[model samples]
Target: MTGRKVIGLREAVAAHVRPGATVYLGNFGAQLFAVGHEIIRQRRTGLHLVIGSGGILLDQLLGAGVLASATFGHCWSPVGPGPTWNFRRAAESGERPVTLYELSLGLLTAALTAGAWDVPFMPVPGLPGTGYTDENWPNGRTSRVDSVFGAADVVAAIVPDVAFVHVDQADADGNGVIPGPLGETLVAAQAARAVVLVAEEVVDTGTARRAGIAVPGLLTSAVVHRPGAVAPDGAIGRYERDVAAYERYVARAATPDGFADWLAGHVTGGRDA
Candidate 1:
């Protein structure tokens, strides 16, 4: 859709996402904390999150029991050696655990690429020994294929029900200009059935075009103007990553009670809290 009206974060998320939906949360660094927090606040449950790299936001979803499953190449805080405590706890605990699908970074990218290309699968080399080539893999999403070269493993395409992206700016037409690294945001946006772009600013179409629009308006279902939405995670040149906030989150989210307290005092209290 073109010339889309900018909407509130809550409204955009509520209108686009549904319970038990398979959702893609854009790139690792450009992850939309505002969207994630809104989903939590709205108590949207049974979500299956697809991410390239799972970080604090994914941990929040896991801790809140909003996720039915998670598919990712890896899970860890960008800050340090500390693991994502909630994800770790959920995976390790026998209680109501979130189903984990661990795939290589290459495979994850291949899946998105295949989806973007509207293909059934994308072949990748050197996946035969990764243990994912077997049918026993949790979801049986990968399989071996014979090629002219030899046998190769191909990952099934993953088209999320909805995708959320955070960008530096966008136009009222929903064309987004995402500065810095491209990462997986573009592919995820294209692969999803619907897309929500949360931008720092909504500018004129000419401004967005001149700024080098990375995501076209045709792929965007909605645009949300949310300044500093990706806080605790940098938005390239717009702001620096909040290391202290991330550290605080890690410390507070280390336990269930601590996570609850942090959620109540910080996330649920609004971004400024």
Candidate 2:
């Protein structure tokens, strides 16, 4: 069906996402800033975010105070390899509102894999003495499971209510191409209850097929035509990562007042990306 699932970003988010919903954002590098910004703008509360590499995108959402909890592999700036001030502050503060569940990239991917497979949990390497198992730094997502070979550490499945994925090109039916590193995006997309395919360009089915469809139409729930959706993060072969933008954001968001002002000027003001 043509344009059956095609919709605006605002409409798609409003339709699929509700307060306190679990949302998976994007790939390791090609983060969906547009969708994150929209979620912030709408002031959606009590969200449980699942991200591959949280980075500044997750930092923005956390700073906006819209998240009740978050599960991520890591959160930082790749540009300067700088700290995400909001995330750092939240983590360090005793009264931080959000609950954090951190895991290794391997474990996170395994969790998504479990979800995709509709399984109970997935076994991973046991880090018995690490902070992951420490009571003081409890992650609350790990456990031991008895198997044929003995006991194994397992990560719980992570099935998000909705997943927003960035793609280079997409068709009307939601089939798309994702170039470069796949990361956890493919599994996260499959694991999600609904997949919103955000594309830099919308082309014909033949074109998308020729480009090699990474996200099948049958697996996609919606398609949003958002060019430069991953700005500041960049799309492979389309643009380079905006280092200045990252640096400026990191500098401006160092303080609470600075972050508020930056949010006002960039996200909540008028600019979408």
Candidate 3:
């Protein structure tokens, strides 16, 4: 545990974070949003985030003016990162919206490819009423990703600048394996430049020692131990969405102030007086 082996939270974040850099993220069970918010709370720089299928954390940042711009697929579903289509409509119409750059219409998985590859356009067919699409954005989806050359940047979907992911377990090398197939976490890690992992427990390295990883070891910049990262009220582990909480949030989403109120009650830590 000596030199360059274990690092602090601040050092880990500062290592990969730069102003104007786009970020990808993963969620733990219930405390994910809190960790993301803590980073924002610590850093003074304005961060632009590109979320895949996101959740309340992104919305909170947007509402707080912490995020300069955001692009994502599904963030409005009652579940985590809700439905991208719903967020798109709100953003385009300037209703309950923040400044957002559009990715082609698809899933959060697609957005990662767009930013990592830096593609001007992505073709996605069957976009409800919109039909197939191409967009000059850092977010979009279509058929299976076929490297960035044919599309543009074969490395386009090759990891973002700073990826924040929360997992159940990881080793000291920052090598992690998800409990199971997660939402958009593993994909985000694969496409990010440097990743900061938040794990409940840092375990021994076993199969994780095998390299040729989907998210290579070098790609992992740091690991923080903080359990209960997401929120049981919003996301139901790897099972289902928090139905009741989501139903309440849609109404609160009508205004930033309302969203803040919700956060104050549940997520945000502050004096109640």
Instruction: State the lDDT of candidate 1 residue by residue for 183-269, as single tens digits.
Output: 777888989999888888889888998999999989998898889888878877788888888888898988899999998887777
Cα lDDT tens digits for candidate 3, 103-201 = 432445555655555664334433433423344333332343456555332212334677887665667787766654466566567667678876655
Query: Largest lDDT belongs to which candidate?
Result: 2
What TM-score does each of the candidates earn? 0.91, 0.95, 0.66
Top model by TM-score, which number?
2
Candidate 1 has an lDDT of: 0.82
> Ranking under lDDT, best-scoring first?
2, 1, 3
Which of 1 and 2 is ahead in lDDT?
A: 2
Model 3 whole-model lDDT (C-alpha atoms): 0.55
Clashing pairs in 1: 3-173
The candidate with the higher TM-score, 1 or 3, is: 1
Estimate every model's Cα lDDT from 0 to 1.
0.82, 0.90, 0.55
